[model samples]
Target: MPGLDIREIVRAANDRWNAAFNSGDAAAVAALYTSDGTVLPPDHAVVKGTAAIADFWAGFISAGVKDHDIELLDAQDGGDMAYSSGKWWATGLGEDGKALRFEGTIVTIFRRQPDGSWKTCLHTWN
Candidate 1:
């Protein structure tokens, strides 16, 4: 069995992410990650560090991105490491009149930080 439950972590992370993105607060979203965290975007190279992560997400914020109705597909826990897959749709002017649907997967390696918060040490996406 996994050492820590990942469902709650994923829920919290997604909540913060959705809130930050909808509010166009890139910095706040980035703050959810560790200082040396890693984010792998679909069309771009790996983004390392919190500053770079913020920069990478800047486009979405500037384009008025909106995420809604996130349906969690699966969650697998492996001690301090876990992954989740889900389907989400974003509807906004940036995506035209059509909603942008994505079958996304996120694998996160969690680290027990000094402050006792489970921070993402590494993250990869499809």
Candidate 2:
């Protein structure tokens, strides 16, 4: 097959991710990953597998994170695998009810599923 339009695919996936996160649905956010997906969160031990990934997101969602934004910078298809680089930012409320914010660069790998949809295989941001 010809090269996949990874830019479009990632754009749509990012939209879904932002929506899921903003809605505080950690399960929905984790559904964007592959079964064996891994997350390398800043300053934290690596989280492996979908369940752990869901738990990681659940913590953030429960912390009242919102307004998540992802800006895709680059993407390339490599047959069954692909990679994307981007920047992201989000806002949340701290335990003290003060506003908290975060922004960082991100790199993610995606694997094409049997159903022809893309899911995150590895994700890292800082």
Candidate 3:
């Protein structure tokens, strides 16, 4: 097979994740990660493993989060490993029905799977 385009792969993954998150499908969002993926969210302890990742996202979804957007800044392929850095933003309704918003920069490491798909191995954001 030809060499993979890291930017395209990561962009597609981000699109998929945004769709899943907007739809409130935490499991689908977690499926974009590797089996033993790790996530480090701002002001939270590290979450490891697919199950833990799914649960973490489930909490956000249940809290009425929506309208996620990911803007890819850079992505590079390094054999079986790749990395991408970007900015993300989202908006949702707060408990009092006011608009709540969040935006941050994210850096994620991805691993190429045997099936030629890229999955996030480490995701950290501030």
Candidate 4:
């Protein structure tokens, strides 16, 4: 791990997120966040804490969203915090039950856990 970089770290974190999300396990997705983690979803009210975040993700999963992906354009770490910014997208069911795509720029902040792993602290996208 001596040569591992911030980009690699962010990618690994996001990979775990995608795995949890794709599997339709909201609890697993929430586990990727810090205990007080929060999500600022587009055009929606802010969601905080692991439980609320789990329900938030459950809403999305129930709405038929899948194939969520992240493309880390930039990543940096300092002290006990790190952040990544880039493209994110997913497909979901529209009102007509047809495939609808959502894509946008996003930034995610993560905190270093006591065990040296990173957990999401904040996320916002537009």
Best by lDDT: 4
Q: After superposition, how far is residue 67 of candidate 2 from its true place, in Å?
A: 0.7
Instruction: Give the per-residue lDDT digits (tens) of candidate 1, residues 27-98.
Output: 887887889989877788889998998887787767656664355667666655566666665655633556
What clash count goes with each model? 0, 0, 0, 0
Q: Which of 1 and 4 is the better model by lDDT?
A: 4
Query: By lDDT, highest first, what's the ranking?
Result: 4, 2, 3, 1
How good is model 1 by TM-score?
0.75
- State the lDDT of candidate 2 residue by residue for 1-126, as single tens digits: 236478999988899999998999999999999999999998999999989999999998887788999999999989899999999999988778899898999999999999888999999999
Measured against the true structure, the TM-scores of the candidates, in listed sequence, are 0.75, 0.93, 0.93, 0.96
Alpha-carbon local distance difference test for all models: 0.69, 0.92, 0.91, 0.93
Instruction: Say which prediction, candidate 1 or candidate 4, comes out ahead on TM-score.
Output: 4
Segments in model 4 whose C-alpha atoms lie over 4 Å from true places: none
TM-score of model 4 (CA atoms): 0.96
What TM-score quantifies how close candidate 3 is to the native fold?
Answer: 0.93
Off by over 4 Å in 2: 1-4
Q: What is the lDDT of residue 76 in candidate 2?
A: 95
What is the C-alpha lDDT profile of model 4 across 9-120, one tens digit per residue?
Answer: 8999999999999999999999999999999998899999999999999999998999999998999988689999999999998888888999999999999898888899
